[model samples]
Target chain A: SQTIHQWPATLVQPVGSPLSLECTVEGTSNPNLYWYRQAAGRGLQLLFYSVGIGQISSEVPQNLSASRPQDRQFILSSKKLLLSDSGFYLCAYERQGAPHEQFFGPGTRLTVL
Target chain B: QQQVKQSPQSLIVQKGGIPIINCAYENTAFDYFPWYQQFPGKGPALLIAIRPDVSEKKEGRFTISFNKSAKQFSLHIMDSQPGDSATYFCAASQITNFGNEKLTFGTGTRLTIIP
Candidate 1:
């Protein structure tokens, strides 16, 4: 069985501060990773997705960016956060050829002050 | 053209009652449709999914009714439980350019089961 892990279950940051969220998947190799954000009372919006290491495709251009540093490790970062950046961030993974089923991590709650 | 329109942003139902949620899409290229359930602060979990070729699929207490010609799909819950109270999201995806599939989600329907 494969498991996905996300760090800093909850975070509180002020505007202009930097942000970093990490996601790691175990028991899978060369999986497709994705980053999604959900605002209060809104559906999820895809932020970024990666096919392989050092390859990322952004769906919505924003202050946030994503990186695949390792095969199973993905990181979402921002040099300076904005008030609009506050939301629930999720990490998801799917097998390379199998894009139908996407498994999600617990998720990180970010609050910008 | 990439939107999946969902109706009844919120629904309230009594325990043991059946709750139905509907969604429609505009993109003909979309071949996969999935429904997710999310608790208050947890990530959305894959509840059920259906392909265009199938008209209906049932798993446990959940069922999905799909209409390919109408470009619409719906989720049905049988003998609903209070534990099923959560926000339901409907999403559609189509394989575009190099096996990369991007999903477009609906506005989400918040389902409340009153006990």
Candidate 2:
């Protein structure tokens, strides 16, 4: 069985501070990874996705960026966070085949003050 | 273009009732439709999915009905319970030649069940 892990489970960052969130998957290799953010009372928004290491596609332009440094390790980073950057961030992984089902990580709740 | 549209931004139902959420897509190329359930502060989980070739698929209390001609799909929850209260999202995707798939999600509907 494959599982995704993300940390820190909750974060509190001051405005204009640097931010980093990490996601790692176990029991799977070369899986598709995605980054999503959900604002309060809003739907999940796709931020970025990666097919392989060093390859990333960003969906919406925002203050955040994503990187796939390893086959199963993905990281979301920001040089300086904005108030709007505060939200619940999620990491997901899908198998490398047709009709793939996405498996989600525990997620991280970031609060910017 | 936003390919998927979902209805009933919020729904409130009593226990033992049924809750239905609808989604429509503009892309004909989408061959896979999936429904996801998300609780407060938790990541969304795949609830059920249906392919365009199939008209309907059911898993436990969750069901997905797909309409190929109309490019529409819906999720129905039977015997809704308080534990079933959550946000539900519909997604569409097409499989690439290389076998990679990317999903485009709907705005999502928040469902609440009263005791």
Give the range where candidate 1 chain A is weakest over 10 consecutive residues by summed lDDT: A39-48
Q: What is the DockQ of each candidate?
A: 0.70, 0.57
Q: Per-residue lDDT for B12-108 in model 2, tens only?
A: 9999999999999998888788889988878899988888899999999988888888888899999999999999999987765546677888888
Best by lDDT: 1
Clash counts for all predictions? 0, 0
How much lDDT does each candidate structure score? Answer: 0.92, 0.88
**Which lDDT tens digits does candidate 1 get at residues B1-115?**
3388987899999999999999999989898999999999888999999989999999999999999988999999999999999999999987756576777888899999999
Looking at model 1, residue A45 earns an lDDT score of 87
Stretches of candidate 1 exceeding 4 Å from the true structure: none
Residue A20 deviation, candidate 1, in Å?
0.8
Judge candidate 2 at residue A9 and give its lDDT. 100
